[model samples]
Target: MIFYIAKRLGTGIVLALLVTLITFLLLASSFEDVARTILGPSATPETVTGIMQAKGWDRPVLVQYFDWLVHLLQGDLGVSVYTSLPVADSVVQRLGVTLSIIVPALILTAVIATALGVWAASRGGVADRIAQGVSLVGYLVPGLLLAIGLVVICAVQLKWLPATGFTPFSEDPAAWVRSITIPVIVLMIGGIANMAAQVRGRMIDELRRDYVRTLRTRGIPPRQIVLQHALRNAASPALTVMSLEFIQMFGAALIIENVFALPGYGSFAFNASLQGDIPVILGIAAFGVLLVVVVNLLTDLANGWLNPKARVR
Candidate 1:
């Protein structure tokens, strides 16, 4: 198990490096005109050249990347050109806000998906068909549209929740929940659909296995066999889907944040990219890639724990 974990961590590190390197190269290339954006249209040629040279933008792409990489290793993500704040600090603040919404939504999604999936798998009648239809619709709907619709119905018309804006959890816990509720629901809808579908399919397959039949023939109760035996074997695939869906939820947060006017990593990245704020943009990109890698690693570990056979590989 230790060896497997080490291997997964090593692979995750390599993938993170490659992602950062590729992102750096792409951003660097597109940033050739970045000095103009920073200095404005009225700035003269010599002014732009001087500013670029002073900021090390005139250096070779590889040289700039190495310099940034060195700073990154030392725990410095560089200073944001727009805000003049350390990129790491800015990202950390936004990340915390984003996670406040994501974590709870994830927990809710898991509980709801698992229960509905297991029940549907066991019942396999009208409930199963209904679950399948809902999952299909949920998976197909765009998150931005869902968020907007919810805001209109719940916030605008019904006046039950705030239409836009965020309140920090520290400021007021109740306001924080009310602020994030719509967005969380938007994220949960798709995640629950995807995870539940995967869990349902896997549970069905596990139920049809020979061991399940043997357990039943041995006088084991259906509920016990399904919950204890079948569910365990089915968990690996459901976990895999959940991990992938979590990443997707993060991506969806980009649009959702804009729709709801939340200050989060997604909004930070979006504004940074538009302004050609390379440092913050690169920082956010690297942070996002690292998160995905970490999630994948954790998922692998969880899979191994649930199914010991996986640790052998």
Candidate 2:
């Protein structure tokens, strides 16, 4: 198990490096333009040149990447051109806000989606139809439209939650929960829609396997066979789907954050992208890459745990 985990970790590290390299190369192609954008139209050509040289943007792309990588390793994400704040510090603050929504939503999504999928597959009648119907509705409804509808009904009409703004959990846990509730539910709807379908399909396939038939012949209880055996095997693929959902949720959260008026990583990244803030954009890219690598690593580990045979592979 330790060796397997180490292997997965090593792979994650390599994946992170490769992704960052590719991202850096793409951004570097127009590296010189960043100085002018930051300085604005009124800035003289000499001033732009000076700024570029000082920031090492004039260096060879490989040299710049290595320098940036070194700084990244040292936990220096550079200062934001607009705010002059350290990117890491800014990201950390906003990341907390985003995680406040994502973590709970993802946890609930995994549990609820798995249960719904398992139940639907095991019941194999009206329950299955109901689950399918729910998935279809979730897929058909645009997330932005869904978020707006929720804001209208829940926040505007019913007055059940705040319409916009956020509270830090450190200051007021209850208020934080209330603030994040609607956005979290919006995120969950998409996650559950995607993951539940995957789980249901995998569970159905597992239940139809010969091992399931043998278990039935051995007089294993239906619930035990389905939940303990088939569900465990089925969960490997669901875990993969769940990991992918984290990235999708991250993208979707950008739109949701705007609708909900939440100050979060997504909002920050969106603004940074618009302004062509290279330092902030690169920092965000690296951070996002790290997150994806970590999630994929955890998914691989979970798959190994669920199926010991995977450890050998």
Candidate 3:
């Protein structure tokens, strides 16, 4: 198990490095374009040259990359070219806001999806068919459209929640919930659909296994057999889907944040890209890759715990 964990950690580190290096190279290749955006098209060649030289853009690409990497390792993500703020600080602030929404949404998604999946799998009647239909629709609908529709119905017409904007939880918890409700619901729909499908399928498979029949023949209670035996065996796949769902939701938050006008990492990265804020862009990209690696690693460990066969190697 330890060896497996170490191997996964090593691989994750390498992948993170490669992602950051590729992002840096791609951004560096567009240095001139970035400079033009920063300096304005009306600026003369001398002005561009002066600005580039001041920013050390004249350095060799390898040297620049090494410097950036070293600084990043030391927790310096550089200053945003557009915002004139430390990239790390800006990203951390925005990420905090995003996490506030993501954490609650994730918890809700996991509990509700898992419950619905187990229920549908156990019943396997009209409820199962209905769940499948809902899951298909939820998964097929585009996130942006879903978010907008929810806003129109729940926020605009019904007037139950705020339509746009974010309020920090510190100032007013109720207002924060009201503001983030739509975005969280939007995130939950897709996550629940994906996770529930995986869970339901796994649960059904577990229920059909020989051990489940043996338990039933031994006069074990149906609920105990399903909950204690089937659910435990089914957990590995469900966990895998949940972990992947987390990554998906992280990516989706980028678009959802924009739709709801939340000042999160998604909006920060989006605006930074449009404005050619290289430092901020790189910071967000690096953070995202690291987050994926960490989540995957954690998921692998959990899977190994749930199913010891995975750790045998």
Q: Model 3, stretches more than 4 Å misplaced?
A: none
User: Whole-model Cα lDDT per candidate?
Assistant: 0.89, 0.89, 0.89
lDDT of 1 by residue, 1-313 (tens): 8799999999999998888899988887766588887888788899888988888988999999989989988989999887899999999999987888888888899989998899889999998998898899987998878887998899999999999999997899999999999989999999989888988999999999999999999999999999999999999988888888888888878888888999997898889888899999889978898899989999999999999999887
lDDT tens digits, residue span 18-41, model 2: 888888899887666778887888
Residue 93 CA displacement from its true place in model 2, Å:
1.3
Could you say which candidate leads in TM-score? 1
lDDT of 2: 0.89
Which scores greater on TM-score, model 1 or model 2?
Answer: 1
For candidate 2, give the lDDT of residue 245: 86
Over the full model, what C-alpha lDDT does candidate 3 score relative to the true structure? 0.89
Worst 10 residues of 3 by lDDT: 29-38
What's the lDDT for residue 48 in model 2?
88
TM-score of each: 0.96, 0.95, 0.96
Taking all chains together, the TM-score of candidate 2 against the true structure is: 0.95
Candidate 2: list runs displaced more than 4 Å. Answer: none
